[model samples]
Target: MSNSDFKGQIVVYSIVGCPFCMRAKQTLRDLELPFLDINLDSYGESVRKEVRERSGRSTVPQIFFNSKHVGGYDDLKALLADKVGLDRLIEEVKNNESPPEAPKVPDSSELKKEKIGDMDFTCELDEHAVLIRDLKMSGIIKDHRKGLTTHKNTFQANQFVDWLVKEKSFDDRATGIVSGQDLLDRGYAAAVKATRDGRFEDNDTLYRLLEHDQNSALNAGLTSECEARPASDLGEDLRKLILSLYNDFLTPDGKSVNYKGIAESSQFKMYTRMTAQLYRVDIKSATREEKIAFFINIYNALVIHGYVAVGAPTNLWQRYKFFNYVSYIIGGQLYSLNDIENGVLRANRKPIGSLSKPFSKSDLRLVVALDQPEPLIHFALVCGAKSCPPIKTYSGKDVMNELKLAAEAFLEGSDGCQVNADKKEVKCSQIFKWYREDFGKNDKDVAVFISNHMGPGEKKTSFLQVISQKDYKVSYMKYNWAINSQ
Candidate 1:
């Protein structure tokens, strides 16, 4: 298959700074395919509508090769795996080779253009003021005046103002000319500068500003806002914005934010407040299962976010707050933080003196008796620390995606199983050590569960065979009680 055939055949609809989008581009580059990247950030409502209608997915990093939707990052990876599929795509690209075209401009006839130096100023100033006020009240122009005030000194802002007046025909004097592009560019630049300078202190204020603007944009029907976007389409600036915002509002205490307070705060209500919004989304769910899953996922994500917030090592031990609390909860029903450390997780399971409590045995038995598939299974894993099995980031619609990623990430990072020329020995995760009964009818069940994913290699089979023979020695590793952070 010819690489040049793809020269004019690929159109990648992506947002900037999206990791998945970057991955897709890298894959295409590795395959020697030339393609056009349409930054969806610049896409107008009509263009976005066309994309959504065609793909039925609102997320970015949507790609069309030879007018066929290739799905998202996962799909692209799958296609590249098959040599025939890769070659076919390459052939199509070579046959359609042509010089790449410039970016397409969406049609917007309502945009009025005027020259600051030459055009007559007939549009009434009063009417424009009213329009601006209406936009602001409708939450479309969030702090428009503040944004415009900052633009007065910037060179790009001046150029944008000039463009609005001379090219877009907006009355420079009466409309107080400035382009939407100018606002976005300046907003992103400001967000980036803040991120690089480690401006965690200003995160709240910055997010409030963006939240205001997002409301304005939505009110104007300029964009649709959702929690989950394809990792490929977000631009660097936007991603930084999101990361900054996510880090800002996390409860330092590792406790859930007051639901009442969250509902009342405009800062928490806007979807642009990613962290606060995520909190609200989790707690607001009426379904108990959904709420439980949300809590588990957010708790795991927050543990990571907390480390980044403090500029600390993204390791489990560093996330002690969650681990200690969760471990306490798992050990028993403890009323307070002190009760857990001093009483439950710390207590000797075996009965002491006149106290008839057989602490260690019950703790062990409770853990053993608990079924693997119970909701508590998630909580138990979270408390597993570094040695525990990985907890997948729960996304409601894409359970499989999260599960597969979690499983693969865990296995790849683990040092458990290895196969020699004629023998196999795997140091399985402590999860198997602690919750052996949950795996199957017996210890052998855990071996089978892991082998399914380990593939049918001689090593995996040998390991399974050894477990079946009951000849393999079972040894427990020192389980890290440290929290899983980054």
Candidate 2:
């Protein structure tokens, strides 16, 4: 059928946690066009079969402008680039020339409720126990001997919501309240007084961890201190944990990170617990290589954690907020993503667009800052974005070599560095432009650094020749901020 034969309907077949699907829907929203979103994940195989039969695609985010297939995200983007053509298609849809056939499956909202109803949230009882245990250990939820009434140990609902927002980075108090109710409903926590008709509140209503044989003794409120582990031991465990996560969810090439799977894994729950132990870890005694490896791993893992928990930042202001807001409490000091990259990794350098260094001379966290900057970390740290470098776990024993290899891999790619032999010009990733000071003082210096880091190849030969002749222009490639999903 011709494109005009289909009109007056827009359908998007998608799945939960798919970034491209979210982008497609967001684009529709921005255009002020109403579309029926169909979540394949919420439907049966028959529905998927129907979608495949109609759209001829098995992947998520199959879109149809009217009954005419618009393909996937990239296709939609290309169509959008042709404004006149897109406007014509939109006008046809608006005119309702011929109403297209509606899918037999329920829309996303109905399917969302159905899916939630199908979930056995009680299965997460043990996981929620781990979460509460760590929250108490971290002193976020103050378990007390005598609170509200003469109950043994209790925490307030407001305190729980605060932890969810400030520490866990839940979007708002409402979500935190809902999660709190889920904890209660799942039997991980119980109402101390059955207040508020059994609904979790954002007020000072009291609750207590449900006594389990596993942690009953630890709930006595006497041991409020975190269980101490040697910094070296914790660091090793952290490294292993990262490797396990990468092995299970990250692709071998590191191009795709299964963030949705990572978020749901038992390993991630362990990671959440381990962050509590970071409060007392002795970072000061670690060797330089140990510190580098530790912070690099932390930075990479935290980026994934932030995206899974808070979502990928969409704009420049949101990016600044994200880097500054998502943080960890290590060695009794709060270290933001920016702090780890700039303060610890970059030797307390000023962050992008910042007039001052991340840490002041008098700041306690300054003690953890490197004496000199390591420029190669820019390649090692993955920012959970498409344009960022590949994810890799590092060991302290071989971190320097690992960093070198990461830099080499990055520069070898067109996104990182591309040599146009005919034009005598070098095009580099915006990473070099953003952290230019780290690479060098000027364009020539940055070009030389890129050339040096590149692995031995014809591209390297061409770049080196260009540098030798001092006849090359350096330009930066536009950065893509899309989430790097599997």
Query: Number of the top candidate by TM-score?
Result: 2
lDDT of 2 by residue, 248-298 (tens): 565433345676787788767656655555644578778888889888877
- State the displacement of the C-alpha of residue 309, model 1, in Å, after optimal TM-score superposition: 2.8
Query: Over the stretch 1-486, how does candidate 1's per-residue lDDT look in tens digits?
Result: 344334546777765323456667767877767777775544344676576566655444677676667866677889977899877766665666433342233445422242111222121122223332333344322222344353211223343344446654677623423333323322211221223222323112232223222211111111122332222111112223422233233233222123233334443233223332221121222233333333344444333332333333335454343333322111111112222222232232211122343223433222212122331232222332445443333434434443443443344333334433234345666656554544566545666766664523345556667666545554445656543232
CA shift at 2, candidate 2, in angstroms?
A: 42
lDDT of 1: 0.39
Tell me the spans in candidate 1 whose CA falls farther than 4 Å from its real position: 1-288, 314-317, 325-421, 430-445, 452-486
Best by lDDT: 2
- TM-scores of all candidate predictions against the true structure: 0.34, 0.54
Candidate 2 regions exceeding 4 Å error are 1-236, 239-261
Q: Which residue pairs clash in candidate 2?
A: none
